[model samples]
Target: MNAKTPTSPVPPYPHPAGGWGSVKALGISLMRDGAPLATASALRKQNKPGGFACVGCAWAKPAKPHLAEFCENGAKATAWELTDKRATPEFFARHSLAELRGWSELELEGAGRLTEPLRYDADSDRYLPVSWDEAIAGIGRALAAQRAADPRATVFYASGRASLEASYMYQLLARLYGNNNLPDSSNMCHESTSVALPETIGVPVGTVRLDDFEQTDAIFFFGQNVGVSSPRMLHQLQEARQRGVPIVTFNPLKEVGLVHFANPQSPAQMLTPGETTISTQYLQVRNGGDLAALTGLCKWLIEADDIAQARGGARVLDAAFIAEHTQGFGAFAQAMRAADWSAIERGSGLPRDALERAAKTYAHATAVLGIYGMGLTQHREGVANVQMLSNLLLLRGNIGRPGAGICPVRGHSNVQGQRSVGITEKPELAPLDRLAELYAFEPPRERGRDTVATCEGVIDGSVRAFVGLGGNFLRAAPDSQRLAAAWAGLDLTVHVATRLNFTHVVPGRESYLLPCLGRIEIDQQAGGAQTVAVEDSTGCFHASDGVAEPAVPTLRSEAAIVAAIAQACLPPNPRVPWNDWVADYAKVRDAIEATWPDVFQGFNQRFRDPGGLPKPNAARERRWETDSGKAQFIVPPPTEHESDPSVLRLMTLRSDDQFNTSIYSLDDRFRNVWGTRRVLFMHPHDMRARGLAEGDMAHVTTVAHDGHRRELAGLRVVPYDLPRGSVGGYFPECNPLLPLQHHAHGSHVPAAKNIPVRVKSAVA
Candidate 1:
């Protein structure tokens, strides 16, 4: 291990996912946040039938509940949100905007929850307290002014933390204001899944449910670190391993979570010293190499099927399922057969025999689940990468069956739900027609800017006003320096959030920070205390009502904030009842039910059920919603392996202590790095090839096709188990190395992974 100047005294963690370390971490978080009693009560309600969902990951709750339903990250998220420390007017008075700007993201948020609405006072270079009504009115006026000038000048952004009702109301507000410039975190994370899944399987969501893990004969994980990102999923994986199921993983780095895990909830795991091994076989696929690897698996499956047919043996391919429910099989098969083996080996950084072994394991299994995360989607050919995985699943008739489907595990709890409730730039006609009928208002038919497009538009002076429902858009996005400048150039910016982030520190010309109730905080309104709902990765719609009181009396619920903004902006409409909707959240759910009747039918009643209703999925029912009325077998074009002996493929990742853009701590326990996020992880061979070694400071420069020379200096190179010719660094910090225009072809998602970079030794 490299010996660099330690950021903290914390040592590298040696054990797997859960165990005593998780307990210790949880205890530390609780103590630091000074909310032990509140956290305990709130955690008990997490993922419960009548309680709030965990704010951490979108992994579904089990049908059978556990006492501790929350994972380690969930505990951190809850503690972080329900912290006793407050960022009050006094705190702001103590620090200047320029001083706060110098602080790290973790430091900015760790200052604690924003107690009240604040407006940036440019004259004083400080944020001062403002009345909720005053903030709302000011934002509404600015939005109206922007609309009068040009509707496209205003952009409405949403974060995944917002509830389904809140998202519905927010989108309604944007559409009513006559702008579809709605871009959310999904554009940066899982947009590829949204684009490719619909084209391939006639649906955009995962076909499998939580229970499918019990029946799955095999599970294949692509670029997902289940242990750190979605720890609860590790329980299911542990059980699968215990049941002798083959779990194959493909990633650029050998993530600790995918290698082994110990369930903290299990008494045996707590008492036992040994941990359960996770992946039966781990393949270190190169960054942006999933497409080639998946194609290789498909090719091997085809070859095996042909050999079986010649020998008059049992068939490997599900021919019956193919003939009945799919299209373009012939073209897909031809493409797979023609895939170059050498190209697959080079692209994937794995030998042909290894891929063959993986294919054999997959072919032998009666049921298989394909799981993936941002790593597959944050690439130049992300859509193609996802389509290739779908192609592999379709070969084995994985769709419309228990334990057999494609599961794109999402990072945010309700990112999928946000899209489901109409928080989208691309509005389908069916939903628009229904919404118009329900609200008696015409929705804008034109397509709006996505995340990448919004950034470009803002930079170019097209987007002038920005309203964020949640999230640190400036930090989470690509080209941080450019984005900061663009955001500052905006005429007005409004953020409804619980805590202070980097985005709040860097204000637009005029900005307002509207403090909102956290997920674990009670939301009281005119009608009474209200409950909000969230959807998990599996499309399960469940209610999430806060158990604790709001961090501050002045804080408002997300639904209330959106409704207030909408009420203030638009003229009074007889058909739309924003006031009534804000008073009771049921009315908002009713509005959603009215719009998407097929999916949200009886939503209010069904949402209260112990296990929330599953959203309607055409792919799960084998009912294709495509033009041909069948799931399409997309034949992704073969991609040549792009390799430069002088440059390494750089992939950006989240530290174990971070969730999305929220940094809990600087320590990344799983990867053994302590107290620092500025270090790079690379294979020893690669470091040696570049005349570098462990703890050597390096300057990393991107080889972008757009000719933008993006670089990050003074990155400490730490030799690790990553594939040769590949390097890894934490995101947000590395986001600068990614060009604004370098993104997936159709999805427009920034290729945070697969950045081509050259590293040179830097004098430190």
Candidate 2:
């Protein structure tokens, strides 16, 4: 490796996920942010019984949380939000929007927190400071004008990072404005699970809780890179592995954390060279082959069950559970039997013997816990992909049983909670009836636009206003360059955020950036201090109270911003006491209980409990809420993107040092990527087949053939342990190569995992 390589010479990080490396990373983050002492105080309160929830991942905290409950990323997030650095008006005045546009994601966010509201000045080509009142009032006026024309003319987007109170208020505000056009970060992540899980098990979320992990006989991981996405989960995994539980992993890449873990919380393990092995069996399936692989598992199980029953051996399938609690089993069994072994092998990139061996592991286990992430959901057949997993779970009566259920690893802290609290485009599920009765206003009943539809609306001139709660919308989107062009046509864009992002720089005609407090910052109001609740991936609604002073005095809570904007947009409504709720979040919780009595019956009281109340999952108790009043076993259609040797499957990855769109640094230690984000990972044989070397630069272009041109050039190819025809690259950068129209079948989430691409030589 020389200067020509342009990347760090270090090989792939050989160490486990969480040890001294995590400690070093946290130290660097605190040092870089200049918030060691300040963040230390915040870190002490992280994930505690009466403290703030971690913004790093949506994983739940234990009943008795560790003294230092936060993970490396958790500490980094705390340090990031509590930093002394500030991107005040002076910072914006110095950099023109065009100049800022050229900056990297890390460079943009590294400038620190936004301290004041800013309005983009076209004349000066910079953001000019504006009072919070004026900014909120302007947004209100724009929404009013949009409402006068068409309620759907404005779309309100919520980031999964906001609290439940904020999301409830945000959705209410949107509905009160005469439209249900609410889209959130979930549209880009686990919307598939929200659809698939409920259809299969009568619940949209995971049924398994923390205690279930302790009882499971076996664990299956699909698609989620827990090490990078949620390393905190590694503790549970490590404990399960140590308990002699059979841990099986199904992914295109054998991620480090899934392979092994060195628990940082344990001194005995961290002090030694030894690391605990996590996965007993690792299956490297094809990029778009998870559905095929899952179908193979079902096929193996059905055949094995028949053999066992005929031979008078012990039963392999849960006959009684299936007969009593489920429907569609016969059709599901028929599909599995009809599936060709040859087709399964080709589609799954696994031989019949290998799948059968893996099936044996599942068949032997009485109870199994299945978990998945974006790898399964961000595909054209995402709904089917998840349904296939549920099919397997049903064969063994996994759901509603101890240590046996589905776990969809969600991104963004409260993304799941956001949907739970009515942040959805579906009219029937938007709490319309209760909201209308409570507020004395008829709520919108028509279906609203999702993420994809919003993009179409942006281009067609149907939507004129864009209000984003938090997170980088433009960069996180697919066909980003195209959407950015259309975004400029919007009449107004308002971003409520704590820091700068690409969305802020890609301003609309009258763009306004309203700074909001982070989850770990003090949110004081008329009630002295405010505490909001966030629901984790497992449906634990825990309170998050900021311990540190806010990044700036001008910052407002997310709920407060939503209230002010709503007040500005609509005339005075005595029924909806927006001001009162903002002053005391408890009032907002009380409203939540009234709006959805069944789900949050004792919201205010339960939310105040230190351990937090775990919302009931009917599926956990073998109760089906589906139309048929029984669990379902759906059979998915054949894969549309069949195997093509010439076309390489390109899946996007998140660098360990980054979150969704916020890059903490350039290096990704887990993957051994350093000093650059332009590197690509592929199998060595595949690299050789393309006449490419390890360090050779290549041009990657999408093979979607959707009449849309997309490509990435000057990327250094690095031979790694991926499937033969599949390659990987970091997200957002590779995001340009993903077609906006290419999305999940039912959920419409961007199918980014297995994109058809051609890696050609760039040395012309």
Candidate 3:
């Protein structure tokens, strides 16, 4: 889907292939489980004292300290944590690891909660139940053996669900073992954003808070659909629209929900036929064409400012702020002036008039907010695209003020926080220095491998053991065909999760599945109930305490698991106080407070509110943290801007019913996709050009860069309203078509949004 193309007017439905799969599962799940017991537990936990943060999305504004604070996904996360089901020792006895591997991702997870530690017995192809002591001993032995062989062979992966305490301990253990090979999920998704943002602004997080939506005069949404990705945000957008704030959208596909969202919170609106008009103007940009659209907008705004100044009116560009806080304005402006309008129009798939109109709308606004998602970041020029966004916001002095700033819609709840707490495989000197002083041990100074590098390491035998906190690393990564093969080469593989996922099925020579506590479950230790801490997208850290008890008595919290593993693998690193921090998360928070006093003040006390304090952004206040104390702009070298007629640009999309890599069901009710994930949306003109028609099965193959042949089959082409030479399809299914090496120009983020491919009709 080209970012410049208008979205299809028809609402998307549940994907037929996957939709029915989810419906059947949901129906049975609801019937068997009844109402979630976690609801009662969560209600009790809210405000009686301090409540735990919602573990769903990183946008943790402190829970309103109210019962309604939790969203549906958050509730599901809670319910899954608090369910009555259990995967006990007996269950493992009945099923082998081989047998579990045969199960589908959804079925395996749906089986039940993990009740005991299980180790793979390759002789029988089964995972036999083992005592905790034995499991720890095996882990210790594995680490000892591997470190003796090669210290850097071990990679420590952290899931975002791991609380601050667990993540700290996890990193400490890795460093103690003499390696910083931490390849967490953050590496796969937002590492590029994290790396690029701080260089432009001082902070990697969004400068805008939820409250900013309340005060904004206009919002420019790029490549983000709130209703599907972050439904909780719909309430905010609906409120903003009701207040007469204009909502402008730039996306290739027209998301129906963005146009006419029925606020589930509004009873009357929910019952009425009318939907809220979200976008006053929608610009359809080409897939991977965001930089051009952004450049065009910036250029148009500059020209408008010149006109305004000549007419003796308010200036659109913040000349003084740019002069004081940013560098390279002259070069940026010069490049913009020199940029060809014809090139912009052709590359963006949007007309010059449309670009000018959108720019004029932005220029007229008193306050503006620019929000984008993976569509902008998962491209060849992802980092530059982000830099361009920062440039646009700076042009009007739109950041660091009330109702104006930049917002990168994060996927996971604590992804940003995980990065903050040293989850990165590539850590800078400052954090390492702080860790060295705080932990008393010299942390690994060398940069470690990221997700891409980690995969390469695994394939080449440089990495022996892979320990994941949560998530299905194999399924979520690009080039599943190759990743699965690489996993077989590992010496040891451990997955600490609540239930079955794809990672558990792909066995290493020695594998272990350790079940841990979920966010909804109560985690009790010697000191009454335990409270875990997590940071949200806005950079506010809050404590999250689970209300309901663990699904089974045998389940342990991730923090407890990390501590036990640390104790097993490495000698005591007293500087971290891993054991004490694991015992009570508050102690960890105290340590964090001690380490970084400038940011998190009285960290434990501030979480008592509904909305946490805003994280600081240097760019927002015209305070540049760069070398020159000025934000530098890059005039990216011009590249060929032609889209071949034979190949269409494919943008991977998630259905409304999906969350991250987890597909709740195939039904995208809003998008009208029913019971199918293997479908593509195309423009009628493109279909006619290729002699293709709707419902035709086609094999989509990518143009070769490194002689990698990637293709998907049996895809029905729905000739809907889409931009010419652009198409849309769900990911994981199309993942095979994306080469592992085909990533962002510099960041190695898989260019999931923009891949050039040719479609051939499948022979009957």
List the candidates' TM-scores in order.
0.97, 0.98, 0.93
Per-structure clash totals for the candidates: 1, 0, 49
lDDT of each: 0.87, 0.88, 0.74
Model 2: CA > 4 A from native: 1-12
**TM-score: model 2 vs. ground truth:** 0.98
Q: Candidate 1, which ten residues in sequence have the lowest lDDT sum? A: 3-12
lDDT of 1 by residue, 466-502 (tens): 9999999998898887788767888898999888999
lDDT of 2: 0.88
